[model samples]
Target: MTIPAPLNGVVPPVCTPLTPDSEVDTASLVALVDHLLEAGVDGLFVLGSTSEVAFLPDAHRRLVVETVTRHVAGQVPVLAGVIDTATLRVVRHAETALAAGADALVATAPFYTRTHPAEIAEHFRLIARRTGAPLFAYDLPVSVHSKLGAELVLELAAEGVLAGLKDSSGDEGGFRSVVLGARSRADVDGFSVLTGSELTVDSALAMGAAGVVPGLGNVDPAGYVRLHRLCVAGEWALARAEQERLCGLFGMVGVGDPARMGRSSSALGAFKAALYLRGVIACPLTAAPQLPLSASEVAAVGKYLAAAGLL
Candidate 1:
């Protein structure tokens, strides 16, 4: 299926369910896909931060893209993350994702090595030139350590070097600047501006964002879908109510003890725990190096689910 130019609506960063040995849980993945499709998500984003892309080996990453793209079968567009530390490596991942049938690719600015702004721009330009596939810049300063400025994003969009942007930088002002800039420029038509902030979907959409790529959408796709609809319908009051409910559920990301695990471990564990309790996946185990949640932490996730009426 062809991806919508300005992709709209709720697009969840699909979680990569893992086996006990940390292999890709294909069966669980397919089930998770069904869960999202049943809830009517506008698109699917796999191998993203929520999916624990950083820890997965190349083979595992390919398996994820293959499993999801094959299972989804084009019912909705599947955007795969081609995140790596540099240009050529990212280009290689992009090729693999494209070969595995991903409809679009999401990548970040080069990381690990400090790159000049010119280098970053050329990084994207090189990937676009090499792959010739629709590319969305993943603006995650927290992880990549390089911020994609609104000016550069607009310049790329205008030049067709980038098709869209997934802003997860948590800078609402910067995000709004990209949104407004994209809309104001006639040459930047069909350039999607998606917010990755689970807490600010309503505000982002209100400010003319194209859609959302919420990680929490994995646990509550229907909630985000409903919130998106309400916002689109101009029902701000109702949207806020729904957003608040989801916001409450978002608290589950903190179930793991900070003293025991890092934020990634806690948040990913919480998501997988929620999925397991919901019976969407067989196991709640995250990838290696990321600590698994304790029974008590899993129980805490259950509490959040119950509070959100999800369980």
Candidate 2:
């Protein structure tokens, strides 16, 4: 399927289920896709931050795209994240994902090395020139350690180098700038501005963002989809109510003890545990080297699930 130029609605950053032995759990992964589909999400995002993309070995990342794209079969767009440290590596993953049937590729700014805005722009330019696939810039400064400036994004969008943006920078003003730029510029038509913030979907949509890429959507996709619809319909009051409820549900991410694990472990563990408790998957195990939630923490996840009426 041709991905919508300005793709809209909820697109969950899918979680990768792992076997205790640390292999990708294909069955659970596919089942998770079904869960999101049934909830009526507009698209599927695999190998993203929520999917443990940074931790996945190259082979497993390929497997994730192949499995999801093949299973989705064009029901909706399948976006594969070509997350890497630089341009050439991202191009390699982008090519592999496209070959595996992905409809578009989402990439982050070149990371780990100190980078300038010119270099970042060149990184994306090179990938766009070489891969020739629809590209979404993932502006996740928290992970990539570099912010994608609105002017730079607009320049690329005007040049046809970027098809869309996934802004997780948590800078509401900056996000609004991109949203406005996309709408105001004739040359930037079909440029999608998506917010990656679950906590601010209502605000983002209110400000003209095309859609959301909520990581928490993996747990309760229907909630996010409902919120999106309310926002799109201009029902601001109702939308805020629903978003607040989901925000409450999002509290589960903090259940793990901080002394024992980093934020990634706590957040991913909470989501996986909720999925397992909801019977969406067989196990809640995360990828190796990440600490698992303790029994108490898992119980905390259960409480959050219960409060959210997901259990």
Candidate 3:
């Protein structure tokens, strides 16, 4: 079967699986992917922020991407996070993924470089031009803090490129702007705008978000699937209540623990922990430098989960 594009159900931003010794464990990695697949996820993401992309070497990144591609076996689309400040590096990664028979690629703007909208547009244009493959723009302003304006995104979409965008901008107005821009224009392909933040999944979906690409969903893929089902069913009352609950869970992840450093440290590590608690993954061991959470925080999570009745 031809791999589906980004717009589907829920695609969990899988945490990078590691060994007890804190190294990339391929066997466990494969197991985790299969586990999530069996749990009802629509797609799998590798080498993303949650996957510890910065820590994994290029060879390791290639290994994870190829492994997912090989094991997924076209059951679902495998999006390798081809993120880098250098456009050439992203292009190279995209080319490699395409060669490995990957279904599609998810890339963001130059993270290290605080580039302008024009520069970001050119960067994606070059990658799209070079690969001639389906591309999704990752607008994660918190990490990169280099916002990719919705208008610029439309400009790329108008060029017969930019099929979708994973908006991690954490701005509802920006999301609305993108949705409005696509709905207003006839030239654009009604580009898919996915939510990268779980806290806003329900809201974004209500605003025409094609799907969600977040790490929190990795904790409870079923919850996201249920939420998506409800949203599609137009059960606004039920969806809103559940969405707020999930948002609360998303908030409970990291409450006063700087071990994971920034979002990467907490989002991925905490998610693996939740999966461990739920009996999905065995170790829940994230990449190194990710000190485990404090006992109090752990207890708080348990209480929060109990309150949410998801523990």
lDDT agreement with native, every candidate: 0.95, 0.94, 0.78
Worst 10-residue lDDT window, candidate 3: 1-10
Badly placed stretches (over 4 Å) of model 1 are none
lDDT winner:
1
Per-residue error at 88 for model 3, in Å?
A: 1.0
What alpha-carbon RMSD in Å does predicted model 2 have with respect to the real structure? 0.7
- The TM-score of candidate 3 is 0.91
Q: Rank the candidates by TM-score, best first.
A: 1, 2, 3
Model 1: worst 10 consecutive residues (lDDT sum): 1-10
> Could you give candidate 2's per-residue lDDT for residues 33-92 as a string of tens digits?
999999999999999999999899999999999999989999999999999999989999
Give the alpha carbon lDDT tens digit for every residue of 44-71 in model 1: 9999999999999999999999999999
Model 1, residue 238: what's the lDDT? 98
lDDT order, best first, reads: 1, 2, 3
Candidate 1 lDDT score relative to the true structure? 0.95
List RMSD in Å for every model shown. Answer: 0.6, 0.7, 2.2
